[model samples]
Target: MQKPLAYRMRPTSIETIVGQQHLVGPGKIIYRMVQAKMLSSMILYGPPGIGKTSIASAIAGSTKYAFRALNAAVNTKKELQIVAEEAKMSGTVILLLDEIHRLDKTKQDFLLPHLESGRIILIGATTENPYINISPAIRSRTQIFELEPLAAADIKTALKRALTDKENGLGHYSVTLTPQALAHYASATNGDLRSALNGLELAVLSTAPDPKTKTITIDLPIAEETLQKKAFSHDADGDAHYDVISAFQKSIRGSDTDAALHYMARLVEAGELVSLMRRLLVIAYEDIGMANLPACARTVNAVLAAEKLGLPEARIPLADAVIELCLSPKSNSGISAIDAALTDVQTGHSGEIPKNLKDAHYKGAEALGRGVDYQYPHNFKGDFVVQQYLPNNLKKKQYYEPKTNGKYEQAFKIQYEKLKKLLK
Candidate 1:
């Protein structure tokens, strides 16, 4: 049976690999390792279709070592045993384990001895951040290399090469790809070579060849239809999920409405409503606090509506909240002030509360000097009075440094400065 176009086009050697020049280029680490025949186990981390597996396949082909592919989350311990046995027989073998972050203790334990003996060179591939997702046991045994996305020019080059490749590509097919079509394939996928190549194949096979020339002419429209939506994989547990969430928050914090909406769209596509709502609430208080008090309340209302509505419809309120938050004035003084106070409390710097501020409701409270000499502010003119609220050790400490980010917070700054001067 014929494999998929993507699988068939896998490069056999490092020289043919489309991207990842940092590692696969001449004089690079992988190139040097293959040239010296000094191969070691390593982990290749990056997004899908960006050549993590290609690097592993190329290394195996270059070194003439046995190559085997397995998914850590899908393959069983028996499968791992087979690869290890082959290593024992063949002197050495290269095992490309995908989603290595999901490797369990049993399979990992079995592979550890073989890895230690240098019999099995493990090439772990993942879309997750290894430092956060993978266990230390497997991580310590392997070197980690991150793959970068293929450039548009690099992808176009690969696509052109595929068109002429008869054995594994569409060389024999009577296909005419226009310049506009080529540009769509290169740019529409957002630097994904696999999507572009395979999309080309689909367009070629699906389109009808003209009766006269017997040529399948792929135009811009066909290219767009073939790849209507770019490949999206947002595993909630993966690094991509966190990366998008981080971007969504930072864009809002930086007051970039468009960028915030873009990331929110990705999260919506992944159906991460719970995470989205929770983060919006946090951003409201942490980033948009005090500056726009109404914005904080509106964000809460929006989150509640989103949680109650759920999905498709839920995105309506969320979109409204995201736009408002992105445009809202940003201030971190509230969170910053609290964190500073927290740091002091955590470091054991919390001295005793002032006697005047201590509880005095109990019958014997006054005997302990609680609430003694307490000047009631309400009984004074203007209903304002100066008193030491903080403990003696922190009497001079000022944590809340208000900013005039918005009119509401500006008023706060005025009042705060007035009180500060009075206390001094």
Candidate 2:
């Protein structure tokens, strides 16, 4: 049976592997290891179709080691033993273990001795974080390397390579891909090179040749139909989900409306209305606090509207909120002040509250000098009084460093500085 174009077009060497320059670029860690032939057991983790399998296969091909691929979850311990037997016969064998996070205890125990002996250079591939999911015994033996999602340019590079390579690609077919069609395959799949290449193959094979010209012309519409415009799904348990969420919040915080909308669109496509709603509320107070009070209130209203309307229509209100959030004068004063106070309390810096501030209504409270020194701020001028509010240890500690980014915060700064001066 013929293999899929993606499988057939796998990079057979480190230099040929596209993207992941941080790992496989010249003078990078993986490249250095390949150059030295000192291949160590390492865990490569990232989102799906982002060169995890390619890196493993490429390393084995480049090193000329007896390479064997097996799934840790599906393969039995006896299957691992067969790979071990091969390692023993050939001195060293490069073993690509897929789903290493799902590895059972028995298989882990069997692989441990071989990994330690340097007889099997274990390359564990996973979409989950090895530090969080894999056992310490397996983790301690391997160096973990994270693989990033391929760039759109990198995806395009791989797609072109597959189109022109005669041996393992669709080079023999007389297919013409327009630039627009090529971009759709690269960008629409969300950095998945495998999807782009497979989409290309589908476009080429399914398309018919021109009667006279005999050329299979793949236009933008054909490419889009072939991939059906892959949408990024939000997996609640997956690591990539959090990464996208993080980017969403940060883009709004950084006041990049375009980027904020981009990440928001991704969440919207995944039907993550609840997550987007909650994050907007947090961003409103934590990022836009005091700087634009009206924007914060409007954000609340937007979220409420979104909740009532739900998706399709929910995306509208959510987009409005994110745009205002991105353009709002940003401040972290509210969250920073609370966090500073929390740090002190958590670190045991909390001292006793002054006696005057204690509850005076309680029985026997007057005997202990509880409210004896307390002044009535209502009776005082400007409804203000100099009094110790914080614990004694934190009397001089300043937490709220207000930003003067907007008119609202400018008014707050004036009042805050006056209060500080009076207290001092």
Candidate 3:
């Protein structure tokens, strides 16, 4: 039996690795270290299917150091001790621990003394942010290398190899991928080579082989069926990022619960950070303004709590906050109103500060009729002295528009009406 395309097509040498030229290319930091035979303890941080485990394996194979692999998810303290004993006998051992973030503090601490002694070189791999997930003491002692997603071109090359390389690839079958079909596969994976190859293999294997053509054509529809989900259509760097976020914000602001949740699900499913979700929550308040003041507080608390609780459990609190924010009363332009007023002053709408509002420390200002005609609101009846606060060029501009929904807005509306009546 032949190995799967993903396993069979694994790059044995650094040169064959699809992505991450920054770390392993000629004269790069890790490349130089490896060439000099001075590889150090390190951490490989990246999302799944980005070659973290493969890179570690390649490093072990290329180096002369005694290599031992352990998974923090399965290995216990006793197993670690045994590995340490082996390292002691070997003098120099390279330990590659996968999913190192799963290790408890005690297990991580167990490796500290060995790591500090320079006896065992440790290389840890994690999908989470090292700053938050890993212990600071351990992180400080290791060099961190981040691996980026494989480019579409890189995935295409890997796909070609999978079709041609017989030992482990799809060489046994008559498979010819069309340009459109390959694009579909590449786009579906979103830079995950494993996913791309798996999808391609399934598409090719399932189709009936034609005797005259002797080739299986994998179309976009076939690939979609195999993958089950459409690829993320938005470009991460382009306007699509902002557009999606704007839609997400608007959905929440408009009180469209389904639309808001759908966008949230899209972001989360795309592997967006919890921190980004928290940021959107803050904007919901600043944009929503007084209409939903509690949304801001709720969002802040969710972010802080998510940091402590971690996912997949932390997702619950985040979801709660998202739903609450979407349902909260909406308001428009509190921060924007203040910002617009400041812009007018800076743009020379007001040539000088009002003398009444200016600092009293300027002695000449009082002599030049600077301190004139300013009514103090607190000293006046009902604390409601009506006076012009805007620049002369920008008068009677309304900034805040509160939506008539939810209890908070109702209360605000009542107070605003009462204040208007009293001032008149």
Q: What does the lDDT come to for candidate 2?
A: 0.87
Off by over 4 Å in 1: 230-321, 330-424
Q: Pairing residues by index, what is the TM-score of model 2? A: 0.64
Task: Identify the superior model by lDDT, candidate 1 or candidate 3.
Answer: 1
Model 2 ranges off by over 4 Å: 230-329, 332-424
lDDT of candidate 1 over 322-354, digit per residue (tens): 999999988999999999999999999899999
**Against the hidden reference, what TM-scores do the models get?**
0.62, 0.64, 0.58
Clashes of each: 0, 0, 0
Task: Arrange candidates by TM-score, descending.
Answer: 2, 1, 3
> Could you tell me which residue pairs clash in candidate 3?
none
What is the Cα root-mean-square deviation between model 1 and the actual structure?
13.1
RMSD of each: 13.1, 12.8, 11.8
**Predicted structure 1, TM vs. truth:** 0.62
lDDT of each: 0.87, 0.87, 0.73
Worst 10 residues of 2 by lDDT: 230-239
